[model samples]
Target: MGERLYLYGIFPAPGPQHLALTGLDNQPIDSHTIEEFTFLFSAAKQERYLASRRNLLGHERVLEAAMQAGFQTLLPLQFGLTTEAWEPVQQELLVPNRDRLKQLFAKLQGRREVSIKVMWEPDQELETLMRENEALRLERDRLQGKQLRMEEVIGIGQAIEQAMEARKLDIIQALRTALNPLAAEVIENEPMTSAMIYNAAYLISWDEEIAFGEQVEALDAQFEERLRIRYNSFTAPYNFSYLAQP
Candidate 1:
């Protein structure tokens, strides 16, 4: 078996068809005499096959299908990793990295990634801030009764800018407190922007989806009255079932 060529991923046992579809049609995974193991190989070398999109898709399909069948797969090699033969994969990479791989798989098993975002149109928020600023109201009232200088008009513009800044900070803080707990980790992608401010988050856990949905639903009920703040949650865009944790 040392001389035989293969690319291996440590997936939960009880599969052979998975191995077959993933590129192991000629070789049987069950035949390996190694303890608690399964492996797959087709005609091409393991490294060469992983380099193409079609092959990478095939690999992910195998792993995801296996996971759906109650098998937890620890994909050691990413889509583009290469190996000369099975021995090097087993003896060199897999052996030296055994503990790390096990820990990674342990963390990834039975878990999925969910992403959440809070976004609002900047114009909506800006309009809301303008309406809520008492200073603007007072300035308008004073200007209504008297002839205003250019400096007074400039001061009003500065006041609006200050009010907008304060409003942005307050809203961001409120959203952070409200949504951060519902996620395992929150990654702010766009931060606060002039067009649309957004907070992106990654939630990890099989159980978190429902809890997160519930939180979004509850927040919707509370913020719906305002009609300015909007929030949503969704699965991340990666095809991999488990997102590599940092």
Candidate 2:
């Protein structure tokens, strides 16, 4: 590849634009229009940009600026997306894929992704389980002084694990039941750690952001003693995109 264009995202226009936003290495961002939508870019020489903090922030700044530019539909390309020239992208990708992309914009317009991360302390839950389950308490008493057998130990560990999973599911179900109706779409991403009970993304419209937040707060208050429900709404809705091409 020769000189490249580090792509940030696409915006459907007739709305305002602020492409003057700086990108990776403080490169001035640029754009190319194909009918109603425009692709945002900047000069690049590297084959691939490393996932450093500065570089990632620069990439995100451009997309977030687009969000602030007053466009209802902003299709944020994934970080590190690049192309050698805009011609092929215009002729091959943009022109050919216009109708499909338009439909995508319709689905994405007026919406933003909201993330919810629910976590709990594993040791605390295990203590609760021990106090509540008589059989588990008996098993603990029986093993207190005897030679610890591998099979007996594994059985107790499995039982505790299953109970923890059930509890996690029940809490998640309650959250979903309350919040899913307010969202246009919901994605349950895999938990990143053992402490995580629910890791989810919701596609919420601008109109429903407040109502959605109130629901989250109520749920958090209800579960505050046992679980911590954290939410983030600042980042772009890239997770819910079909145009976030790498």
Candidate achieving the largest lDDT? 2
Count of backbone collisions within predicted model 1: 0
- Candidate 2 regions off by >4 Å? 1-3, 14-18, 148-150, 243-246
Candidate 1's C-alpha runs over 4 A off are: 1-67, 72-96, 136-166, 182-196, 225-246
| lDDT of the structure predicted as candidate 2 | 0.81
- Residue 17 in candidate 2 has what lDDT? 48
lDDT of candidate 2 over 36-92, digit per residue (tens): 878888888678999999889888888878777775577778889888977777887
Span of ten consecutive residues with least summed lDDT in model 1: 25-34
User: How far is 162's C-alpha from truth in model 1 (Å)?
Assistant: 5.6
